[model samples]
Target: MALQVILFMTHRGRTQQLVLRLLQARRLFPEDRTGSRTRHQRIAERLGLGYQVSVMVPALLWVLTPALVDAMSAPAANGTAATRGTPLPVWAPFDLQRSPNYELVYAVQAVTNVVMNLTGLFLDVFFVTLMLHLTAELDVLNLNVASLRPSPVAPADSLESRDGDSLAKQASTDAPYTARGDSFRVRTSTSRFHMYRLLVKNIQHHQMIIM
Candidate 1:
């Protein structure tokens, strides 16, 4: 069990390090691209691999845990022979004569099986949730990137004369007034949809002014 714990911790630590490295690489070179793929794609592939390992390790352990417990409790060859010698620390726990509580041993194994199953279940749920969350975040990031890209038609050219006139009039009356300066600031606290609409309206007004 101690060895298993050590191996699990080692795997977890390495997985975390790999994921962090991938994230850092993505951040450092977001626009970097291969022949047919972008940095995001590369990072995603690495993340997916890490996720698979995270899921598979626990599942493998879950499958083998019962067998391992049974093997540990199984009687050795030349059964029912008592050994009267110095007690070695490693073999003391397995000495059935010295510890003849078969019921307790069985109870411990049952509890271990229950704990292993619960741990597996928890890990499955956690990984599923994490994958869903990462997918949603990636989708949102893609949408925001698409929205920010420049369209083929310039904003000034897209507006009709009548729309421009109306926008100018609206801007003169309704837009926040500010003096000419090197920089300006605008502040608002609003819901996302409302903020998006407000931004579109402001962009149209600015296009009208520029034209």
Candidate 2:
């Protein structure tokens, strides 16, 4: 019973998270995609268990009402039916003890329990849907956040890569000079201490011949 009480709470953390995430995403993605405006026929499909079973929680409660009442109204092993107008020590958690009305109280409590269970099921599924949508919204949030984040090491990274390539070329003793787009090129010679001369610039004014 204690476990049931804890698990039966209708207010869920996931529902709150979903609502919060949806609100956060709404600022950036203002448009919502609701169903189409035109009337449409429902598609008939076979549903196995776990397929939208949440939708039937309340309906199933009504269907099981008679059986639930019968189960609760059964006498205990002692087999003592109550006297008229006096409550009976029914096996129920609550006082069903009424002389003639014992069965009525017993039935009512059974229905109440079933109804509560149905309510809990509804709350659980709604939370699950909310959490699922929250996850998608969180992805959207991450993208929006990333869009505003600045590139950290772009310039330095390019310089480091170039340096690494130059060192590799030197290590192999193969400085097969090739002209690249508008950037500086190295003219190689084994005689020079540095073993290369830099030819800078495509524009005349910026031209420099480095030894």
Candidate 3:
């Protein structure tokens, strides 16, 4: 526990920076490419639920087992005081082995144990959420790349006559296109400009993830 605390303290600044970068990247790629509450959100929710169940089930068993055993093995009314164990072993200022005291201490320990487990689970969830969002962004980038198509060939003789047709086709096919729409056109000075822009954007995204 001490080591975990120390590690958290040491890496707190770095974690903050990572979170900041993630936020900035979100702004850069804000479009929900897969529509509302995409696959990543669903995955995160399932993972979080699984984590909660995984943490809580063991904790419940740990807390209840000792109490169940003690109840079944309780000393007879005529017998002397029986030894009892707390859910967790810990020293208390007062005698926690006595009635009400033991129950109260046990309840406190159970609550504390659950809270501690949940705290750790929350940390796990935070990192997992970040990873999921990163993956979602990468997936979006892939879709963008996949949507790109090589410019269709225009016959040299027909190129002059089909100039308007080519432009109209480009507009229809690449609706919502950005300024960097130049494709592999032999006559265009901005040939492959869209691909270059895409490459640069991906590189910047990669750098953001790295940082």
Candidate 4:
């Protein structure tokens, strides 16, 4: 959903943070397609897999936007064409047909975001699990035969969550507490719930996520 905010601010373009990192990464990993394998996964490490998600999540959300818009704009009725050109089964669940306007556009965006973020998170976790499973079939190969390739994997001790001391405290086992106004975390299996929560927050509070 942070990414959705970025794209909403950036308008479907390469995110500024991503563009900078991509350039930096390309410069470091100039030996593209060396026709061999490398244990270091230089490119992946240069721009962490989490950051690479910047490109993918937005692209997918873009693909879904039109379909969602189409669905929302369809007829108000919900049926399987037994009636006169009733709405599609998928679109009927949305509350769009009440009084379509600019408000509908915002609702469309929010709904799309909920779907996009949730789907992306699920796919991310799935891919990570698949990667861990691939360790069993792993093979060793060098990326460069004649050129020197530096190791990209950093010290394990340096890895840490930047969610911060406050967030850590919030997630800590001390007590279920609220921080900075009414913000309190909720457990979600899918990122959609997170997105849904944010949408509800912005709508109910009449504020925008400028950050």
By summed lDDT, which 10 consecutive residues of candidate 1 come out lowest? Answer: 83-92
The superposed Cα distance between candidate 4 and the true structure at residue 10, in angstroms, equals 38
Q: Estimated TM-score per prediction?
A: 0.31, 0.33, 0.67, 0.21
In model 3, the worst 10-residue window by lDDT is 154-163
Predicted structure 1: lDDT: 0.44
TM-score leader: 3
Q: Which tens-of-lDDT digit does each residue in 30-117 have in candidate 4? A: 3335422233344334444664477566756664665566566655577432221111223456554344633465456656655666
lDDT of 4 at 63: 49
What Cα-based lDDT does every candidate model obtain? 0.44, 0.41, 0.71, 0.41
What TM value does model 2 have?
0.33
Off by over 4 Å in 2: 1-18, 30-103, 138-211
- How do the residues 112-162 of candidate 2 rate in per-residue lDDT, one tens digit apiece? 666665665555555555444544444443433333422232222122123
Model 1 per-residue lDDT tens digits across residues 1-211 = 4555566577897646545644543343233132112433555556666766776667556545644655566465869543332211124356543544543454455566556655555555545544543443344334434445332322322222322232233222323323344253221212332455545644543332223
Q: How many backbone clashes does candidate 2 have?
A: 8
Return the top candidate by lDDT: 3
Residue 88, candidate 4: how far off, in angstroms?
A: 8.6
